[model samples]
Target: MSVRSLPSPADDPSTDIPPPPEYDGNLPFAAAGPEPARTGGERLYVAMTGAIVAGPFLALGVGGWLLWGRLIHPADLLLALGLYTITGLGVTVGFHRGLTHGSYTARRSVRIALAVAGSMSFQGDVIGWVAIHRRHHAFTDRPGDPHSPYRYGTHLRGQLRGLVHSHVGWLFRNERTPADRYAPDLLADRDIRAVSRAFPALCLLTLALPFGVGWAIGGTWTYALTALLWAGLVRIALLHHVTWSVNSLCHLIGERPFRTHRHDRATNLWPLALLSFGESWHNLHHADPTSARHGVDHGQIDPSAAVIRLLERLGWVRDVRWPTPDRIDARRA
Candidate 1:
C-alpha cells in the first residue's frame, strides 16, 4: 500500500505541466516507436486477453437480440442484477476500498470472503488487481500508471487515442505490475494467497453458478443459456466498462473538486456513480486515498459505503476511515 515510490512533480516549461517518471513503458504509447514482434507466448497472452474482452461484448449483442425477440425471462434479469451487485461490490468495497487502501480492518473470515467475491468479478486475481491499482495511484496519469488516458500527450488525436488506451487497449499490452513490490502485505497473508490461487476456480464458479441456477429455476437448457448470457457475460461486460470508465472518462470529464497529485486528473463523474458503486467519485478518492467513504458530499449515492457501514454494524469490520468535514475541507481544490 506504500505509494512512496511516486516521484516528486517536475516542471515542464513548454506545457506548464509535469511529465511522468520513466518506467517500463508500453510500446504503443512510446512516441514514434515501432510495434515489437510478438513471441508465441506473447501471442497467446494477447489472444486470451482478446477473448476475455470480446466474449462479454458478443454476449451483450446476443442478449439484446434475445431481448428484442421478447424471449428474455424475468429470472434472467433478476439473476443479472443479483450477480452484478455482489461482484461489483466485491471489486469496489473489497478489492479497491478495503484491501488496496486499508480503509478498514475486516474480520479474518470477512476479509477472505470479500477477497473470494472480488476474484469472481473476472478482474484478475485479488493480489494482482491490488498491485496494479496501487501502482496506478503511485504514478497516476504519469509515465508508470498502467491505464492513464494522458499517456499519448494532450492533443486532439492523442486524447482520442489515449481514451481507447485507458479504457481497454492497455489491457492488451504487456504492462505487468510487480505484486511483490506493491502488494507484499497481501502476499504475506496466507488466506489472501489462498484466495489468489483459487482465482481460476472462482472464475468458473462465477459462470457455472448462473447456469446451474437458471436451469434449476426454469428447468430448461434455453433458460440456462439465456441466464448465462445476461447474468454471466453481459453482467461482466457492464461492470468492466463501468470500472474502466473510472480509469478513462472519470479522468477526462467531470468535476475535480478535490486536489490530487500533480498530473493526476481524476474527476467525480456523476453519471457513473451508481454503476461504479461510487467509485466514479474519483477526485475525492485520489485526494484521500485511504478514506472508506468516497461520496462524502451530501446526496451523493455510494452503495459501497453503505455496504461497508452494514459490515461495520455487523462487527465484520472496524477502524473505518470515514471522511470528516475538516478533512474534506483540507483537500478542496
Candidate 2:
C-alpha cells in the first residue's frame, strides 16, 4: 500500500480525544528561571542522567575493540534485537500511547506488565515520563514544551541549537513535570506507582539480564561483557536517540499533513517508522492523540498499533480508538 497524499489545507479529525490545552503565543521563548543550583540530590540526578546519556556512547568504542578482536558473537546480536523490540514497544505502546494518551484500555495485568517493561528502558519512572510527555502535548512546539526543536526559534542558527537541545540537552535540565498536574491518573494507580518506584532497579536489571544470559549461553565472562556492551548499553542508546528524534527531527523535518493546534508542527517521518514502531508518523498523533493508530494511511507501518490490536484480540485490552476512514479523511491537510 502506498501512502496517500492530501491537499494543502487542514481539517480536524472527529474523535473523542480532546485537543491538548491551548496556550496563547505570548509566553517567553527562553527558559524562564534562574539556573538551578546543584544540591546533593540534584548532583546525583545530573550524574545519573549523564551516565544514561553517555554510557551507551562509551560502549560503542569498546564494541569496536571487540569487533577488531573477533570477540563479537551472534547471540549478542540476537539478544540485543530481542530486548530492543520489547523495551521499545513498552515505551511506544505502553508509556506513550496507552498510559499517556489512553489510546486503549488494557487489562490490569497487561497494564502493569507494560509499565514494568517500559521502566526497564531507563527513560524514567512511568509516572514522570507520562507527566513530561503530557506537558509536551499540552504546549507542543511552544513556550511550555519541555523539548521542542523550535524552542530557540525558527532561524537557522537557533534551529541547529534547538535541535541539539530538544534531542538530548533538555534531559539534564531541572525542569519538572508534576504528576498531580499532568498525570493524575497514573499517579493514583497503585500498580503504576510500584512500577515507577522500581525504575532504578529496572535500569540495573536491563543491563544485568543480558550479562547473565550471555554467560549462560556462551560460558565465559568475555561473552557476558560483550553482551553487556551491545545488548545492554548500545541497545539503550539506540532507543534513546530514536525516541528523541521524534521530539527533535519529527517536528523540524518531514511531511505535515494533518491539522494540529497552532504552533504544533509534528510531521510524518517515514525513515524512522520501523525503528520507532510507527511513532514517526507524529503529525497524525498530534492531530488525533487518542487514536489507537498513528500510521492511519496506506503502507505506513505501525508495529505498536499491531501490538495493541493483538492485545485487543486476546482480550487483554479494549476500547481501542481505532481511526475510521472518515476520521482519517477528515484529518487530511
Candidate 3:
C-alpha cells in the first residue's frame, strides 16, 4: 500500500498551462532570423532617399562654407524651426497618438489639421501611415512586425543588419500594411480618405509653403531657394531620421524601465526625448499603448502630451488617455 501522490505541474505534459499571452519570460528577438532578400526596387528607393536627403545637406555645408554669412540668415533659421515644430507635432499628436492609437479624440477640424501636419512630415499618407503603425503595435518586434530591428538574429552582424533594415531599409520593401485590416476607422472617414488621396499634393505644399514664406520675408529668389533647402529638404531629413530612430534606435539602445509585451524591446531613449517630441520614451509607450503621455516618469518632458493637454483645455480634443499612477505602476518592470 502506498500513499496517494499529489499531482504536480510536471506530472503530465498536457497539464502544462501556457503563460499569459502578454509575456511568459520567453525571448523571441534572439530567435528571429534574418529577413528575406530585399528586391532591386527596394534597394533603389533606399539609395535615392539617401542621395536626395544627403545631397542637399552636402550642398548646404559646402555652400555655407563658400557663402558663410550669406547662408546664415535669421529668417531661414526661424522658418525651418517653425515648420519643424508644427509638422513634428502633427505626426506626434495627430498621426501617432490621435489617429494611430486613439489616445485622444479630436474634433473634425482638429483631426484635419493634425492629419495635414503629419503629412507635412512626409512619412506617408495618413491612412497608410496609421495602418502601418497600427500593424506595428499589433505585431511589435515579433516576426510579423514591418520594421523590427531584431528581424535578423540578435548576434552582432544580425543586430547591425537589423538596425539598418529597421532604420530605413524596410521602407524599400513593397509589402504595405492592409489598411482595411489595421485602419478601418480611417478608411470609413471621408475626411481621412480625402487627405490620403491628396498626400502627394500635400508633400509638395509643405515644401512650397516654406519657400513662399521665405520669398515674401526676404524679397529674393535666393532666400526662397535657401528656405526650400533648409526648411523643406533639410528639415524633412532631420525629422525623418528622428522619427525613424524611435523605430530603430529606441528598440536597440536606451533604458528599458518598463516591461512590454513578450519580446518587445522598445526602450526609453533620452537623448531623443526632446527632438522626438517625447516619442523617445518608447518603452513606456509599448507598456501602456493607450496612454497619451509616453514620457510618464518625472522630468520626462513630453511635449506631445503638453500639446494634447492644451487641446483638451481648448475643447478641441476629448478622451485624452493620460496615464494614472496605478496604470504606470502596473506596467513597471
lDDT of 3 by residue, 162-186 (tens): 8998988877664668888667778
TM per model?
0.91, 0.91, 0.85
How close to the true structure is residue 305 of candidate 1, measured as C-alpha lDDT?
A: 95
Whole-model lDDT per candidate: 0.85, 0.85, 0.80
- CA deviation > 4 Å runs, candidate 1: 1-36
The C-alpha RMSD in Å for every predicted model, in order, reads 4.6, 6.1, 9.6
Error of 1 at 164 (Å): 0.2
* Each model's backbone clash number: 0, 1, 0
- lDDT tens string, model 1, 1-333? 322222211111232234434422332345526778899999999998898899998888988888899878999999999999999999999898888888888888988888888898898999999988887887788677899988887877888999999999999997778988778888888889999999999999989999999999999999999889899999999998899899999989999999887778999989889999999999999888888899989888999999999999999999888999999999998
User: Tens digits of per-residue lDDT for model 2 on 111-191?
Assistant: 888998889888999999988987788778887789988777777787888899999999988588888877777767888
Pairwise TM-score winner, candidates 2 and 3? 2
Q: List the residue pairs that clash in candidate 3.
A: none
**Model 1: ten consecutive residues of lowest lDDT:** 3-12
